[model samples]
Target: MKEIRFENVCKSYGKTEVVKNLNLTIKEGERLILLGPSGCGKSTTLRMIAGLEDITSGSLYMGDKRVNELPSGKRNVGMVFQNYALYPHMNVIQNITYGLKVQKFPKDEINLRTDAALGMLQLKGYENRLPKDLSGGQRQRVALARAVVKQSDYFLLDEPLSNLDAQLRVSARKELVKIHELYKQTFVYVTHDQVEAMTVGDRIALMYQGHLQMVDTPENVYNRPANIFTAKFIGSPPMNVIDMAFDNSNDSAYLAGQEIPLQEEWRNYIRQTGVKELAFGIRPEHITLSKTQLKNGLKGFVKYVENHGSSYGVYIDLEGNEIIAMSESNKWPPKEAIYVEPRLDKMHVFDKQTTNSIGYPTSIR
Candidate 1:
């Protein structure tokens, strides 16, 4: 395995820059994911690392060696694409050993490596089966097996599970994790699925509009997002960001007509930054519903409810704004009137103008 580094890397098509100046480092044997929506330049970044695209500026490194000029075949990287990309007439064994055959390895060595890959991927008895004969999940395993048999220093996976059904994707995720654990190789995966990035990656790089937003573990990104774009993009159903104005006329700040007690450090930060407008944010799971209003909260009407089998989502209208909360209990509040109090410690505060988190300091857990 090798450490991968990108220093101020960029890509452009004619005059429009697809990937802006980006810098990142992926540790050896680490599982890193690039996550964002379409046109966010994630795939372009992956292609650059795989030597399939030219870097418009900056440098790329594998460990200490600068590889910005290396060709794809000479980079010693294995890539698995969204489509299987298998030869139509080739069977599993042929597909797995094709690289070795082209390299002119001994026939016995080819058999040995192919057999090991087949066994590792749980394709032990399907060597002769053609690609058309295999299921989607099985074909995916074959793709992985081929990458494994190549003995590459790094693995690049670009939406490898997007072609599979939901159930198969779930199962395949576990399998991919196991394969990473067994092989102990540096893996860089790209996908738009936040769930996949959260569950699969050791560290995630969140991007938007060709810019790198933040890079951290799943828990850190979810609990203490660096900016508003991350908090709005990383979670399902998203975080509730209520518009609020900080009243600086008094000695302390007030949010929604309620006094906000700032931590000693945060008070200093606000004073230094000269922040005036703030947004109060919280996740759905951190809210509790009641029939009466609390001293520091709001009373709202339940607009609708969604039953997701494991839990219920109660959407409420607070004043004129909408907020959604997740409930563990099957019993729900009345649809007409209800109150919600967000757990104070679980709340987030962001600059209303810049949209960057400013409430609490966090460390990776």
Candidate 2:
């Protein structure tokens, strides 16, 4: 396995810049995932690393060797594409052995690698089956076995599970994780599904508008987003962002004219943002509800209920605005009156102007 590095990498199409001055490093044996919506350049980055796309500028290195000038074959990288690019006529064993044969390896070496890969992918008995005869997930495994036979130091998976059904995708994901664990190769995966990234990746690079927003662990990305875009993108139902104004003299923050006591950490973040008009954020899970109005919480009317099995999504209408909250219990409160309270410690404060998080200070812990 080898470390992959992108130094000020830039990719352009005529006048439009699709990837801009990206600097990232994938350490040896790390499972790194690039996540973003289509047109965000996540796939482009993966293709560039695989040497499928030419680097417009800057350098890319695998371990200590510069690979930008090398072709895909010379880059010592294995890639599994979204479509499971397997030969339709070739059986699984043929596809897996094709790479080793081309490399002119000894017959014994070819058999050794192919057998090991097929066994790891749990395709030991289906080696004689053609791609057309195999299930979608099995075909994908055949494609993966082909790549593994190459025995490259780096692996690039570009939405490798996108073609499979949801149930098959789950099984395929588990197999892929097992492969990664067994091989311990440097893995770079690209996908638009945040759930896939969160579950399978060791670290996630959250991208947007052709730029890297944040590279962090799943927990950090969800709990402490770098910006508003990330804050809304990572969560299931997402955080509720409302316009909040702070009164410095009163040492209080107002959410829809309700005076809520600001914790010292939040107060510090407010001072750091230095803006009067800030956005207050709270996750759906962080908000609690009751049939009767509480003393410290805010009052709002129940707008709607969505049953999501084992939990209920409650939307509250406060002053013509909708604030959504999730409750583990599906029991509904009265439509006319429902009190909602936010756990202040779980709140997030961001700068209104820059849209960046002004996080709570460490001393407040």
Q: Candidate 1 — which pairs collide?
A: none
**Most TM-score-accurate candidate:** 2
By how many angstroms RMSD does model 1 differ from the true structure? 2.4
**Using alpha carbons, what is the TM-score of model 2?**
0.95
RMSD of each: 2.4, 1.7
- For candidate 1, the per-residue lDDT at 156 reads 94
Sum up the clashes in candidate 1. Answer: 0
lDDT string for model 2 (139-242, tens) is 88898888888878898999999988898888888888888888889999999988899899999998898899999998889888888888998888888888
lDDT, model 1, position 342: 80
**TM-score, per-candidate, Cα-based:** 0.92, 0.95
- Residue-wise C-alpha lDDT for candidate 1, range 46-86, written one tens digit per residue: 99989999999999998788998999888888889889798
Total backbone collisions for each predicted model: 0, 0
